[model samples]
Target chain A: MSKLASMLSTIMILFPGVAMATPDIIRQQLPQSVPHYWKWGSLFVNLQVNYFKVFFLVALLAIIIIEFLHFVIIGPKKFRESGKKIRVYNLFVRIVHWTAALSFTLLVPTGLIIVFSKFFGGDGFVRAMRSLHFIGAILFAISVVPLFFMWVLHMLPEEGDIRWFMVGGGYLTKKEVETGAGRFNPGQKIWFWIATVFGTLLFLTGFLMYLRKPNFVIPFVKYQIDALRLAAITHNLIAVIVLIMFLVHLYMSLFAVKGSLKSMITGYKDEEELKYMHSSFYEKIKHKLNE
Target chain B: MYKYSRMKFYCDENRCINCHGCEVACQVGNDLPVDIARRKVITFNEGIEGKEYSLSISCMHCTDAPCAQVCPVQCFYIREDGIVLHDKDKCIGCGYCLYACPFGAPQFPKDGAFGTRGVMDKCTMCAGGPAPTFSEKEKRLYGQNRIAEGKVPLCAAMCSTNALIVGDAEHVSQIIRERRMAHGHGVLDETPYGWDIAYPNE
Candidate 1:
């Protein structure tokens, strides 16, 4: 019985439809003959039909989910947080953040242009769309400069990070005690690292592709093409994760934590909330006042 | 643009002879790098004798161009004449275009001074490039946009069998219609060829 069960499981994985072929067994099983001269013409048409719609839907769904969650569920929650809630993200940071977002949005469409044009068909519209997409990529690189600087001062890891990652830093428990850390949290620091590495990979890969330089030291068009393919997959996967992180950030800033969004907009947080939420820094400042 | 009125390219498989003439003509005319073809001649069923026909595939420039819709910086533009082009300086070497293009047209050089070629090169429909008429930079990077100089693409012009055709939509369609009528109905089984061969290994 065990041997029979094992065989059944193997067949299930290797050929799921094979088990259901009892009815098909009696049906016509003749190999479909190719048209006399039709074989050459069917190659490009078949592949395009297979891949274009699948990838398009995956990308479209990811973007829509991220956007919907940010604007609808998370945006309002941070507006109602207690205590001081002003000035979390400065003007320069805000500018860079939005610019990065806009550039990323452009990258999606342009990327799609190259994919669909080859396998499916490139029309005049696809060509025009790609032009704008490349332009957006340039802007994404430009936006990085300002964003890089705004976070340069705050990215170093702190001792509290180890505890924060492990213990949820009182956020989960609602204990409302400030961990002895300054500036950003360990989670935010990790996000910075992800963005930095992935962004650099995208920039380097993108430029190489644009300049038409396919000669990797290994020397093959297929190699360069493969590398580019890997980069694209990585870029897309990372984008989905980052967008999800941004959704969390949006939730905390706008809806989860009341008055938190105000700090980003107006650049000031309430003193009482600061002391309650960030007691370590508050204590340092309050002590200095007593001195 | 709506679906029906959007511009498209249709390949005639019957006339192609596997000679790769279109591929070579495009490279020579555009000054594209060695081993870099903005357009390629692909054969689906080879070694079958008299059953093989080659298709020269490149960018199709779609109506609902997925690439344009996804660009974050809004860099794409639509010309009144329906030719699509871009600014190289404004391009970041992201491979998004590769994923989005269905025809696999855009190619990165991958062989330059820095061991990295950071710009994309592809067919500009012989419409020249993104510069003023006959500028050296446009000519150097994108080859001569001969269409702007009142010439059709050299590939189509040089087609030995006159298989490939290019021009305004109406003109090209009229030509194809005439060919079909001369050959009789169903004489050429309009099986869009490029898309099938483009992903053959998969």
Candidate 2:
């Protein structure tokens, strides 16, 4: 028996494939060039398991602190309720805007809860939050298409955009300066693109994640990549960018510029706000006011 | 002093015939849904003469389980004997555990609207759950609790070739070592297939 076993072992060693076939076959099947992003020691796992929660928490705190300090020191861009209102947003526009806003309100908190789930403790509450996250995704999906087409023309970069950026859209200082902005200020335009473009990417990646096993092949690649892992990495990265911009949008609408929130609600902007913040836009629209 | 023992499962690749008996046994014994497989048999190098081998895989119940780490609800818990388990009630079915798990051990039933996932399900090693051991609720939620009754897991028990073994880590390793020696193999340079990722410290 010992002699037979030794002979068998010698034969196995000489013909490795006979004894251990899987390793060589696996190597041949998978592309050697592309790194496996889903496994440990990769950037995707490290970010998801270690740093995502910290990054989100720090970003939230920084935005809140900075905005709070700005509010205290420079104060809001106060404008008198000039009794007369300009119809800046139509009813359809207001409806679409609020629908997107509602989605954000749901998505942001629930997404944060998911990221900080360890602290919150898993249960029905967090589970419900996850369900609500999906609901928010649905609402956003409904609103994004209309929201994009309705405002894309207005959101295009104008000659005055450079000047608006240079003067910081008259946001830094108390003194009212000529911002040379359009109907949608350069700041609002930036927020618009971020919300629409990055928001779409978020939805697509999120849909991929929702599928659980998105194993389709890429157009030019010979080897299949772990699509679920790639989606997760991309989703988290885009989420961070979108979160920061959303906070800025929230601050600008609710606090940074007084009466800005009213326009979305009532489909009208105060004449005083229109003149100072959107000076060039006011210059063009004032003729109609005079008429 | 009582010796510390961590329960683990070891699959002898050379011995596995890929008959899928383990998978069928687990499914039938647990009354699992058709879609949810607690254990599976994977055959590598299929149809290749003298180069084909098979492996039976499920949750390894790692010392530091990634599913436990990533679960938003802190639902997963490791028992004193190192059997990884989770509370079904606490699981929200967010699928984070699936992403974190290297073996794709976590399984979700599409029990929600628009195909949204319900709570997670996976191999329990037949140890049941936090529910009262051997009770109807425990059996319904987490299948059989053979471990509690001092019996081997159904899959391992049903393996015809004795390819799948489950027991204390030390005992499992001893069996593996004995098998290697009997086969005239020398000391292996590497650990078992997923041991490096699953039990880094060990």
Which structure among the candidates has the greatest lDDT?
A: 2
TM-score of each: 0.48, 0.87
Residue-by-residue lDDT tens digits, candidate 1, A215-291: 22323422333344444455445554554555455556555557666666677777666665555556557755445
Highest-TM-score candidate = 2
Q: Give the per-residue Cα lDDT of candidate 2 at A91.
A: 93
Please identify model 2 stretches exceeding 4 Å from their true place. Answer: A1-42, A218-225, B1-4
Kindly report the docking quality category of candidate 2. incorrect
* lDDT for each residue of candidate 2 in B15-83, tens digit (9 for 90 to 100): 998899999999999999876878877766688999878888889898788778766568889998989
lDDT of 1 at A12: 46
Candidate 2 chain A has its poorest 10 consecutive residues by lDDT at: A20-29
Alpha-carbon DockQ of candidate 2: 0.21
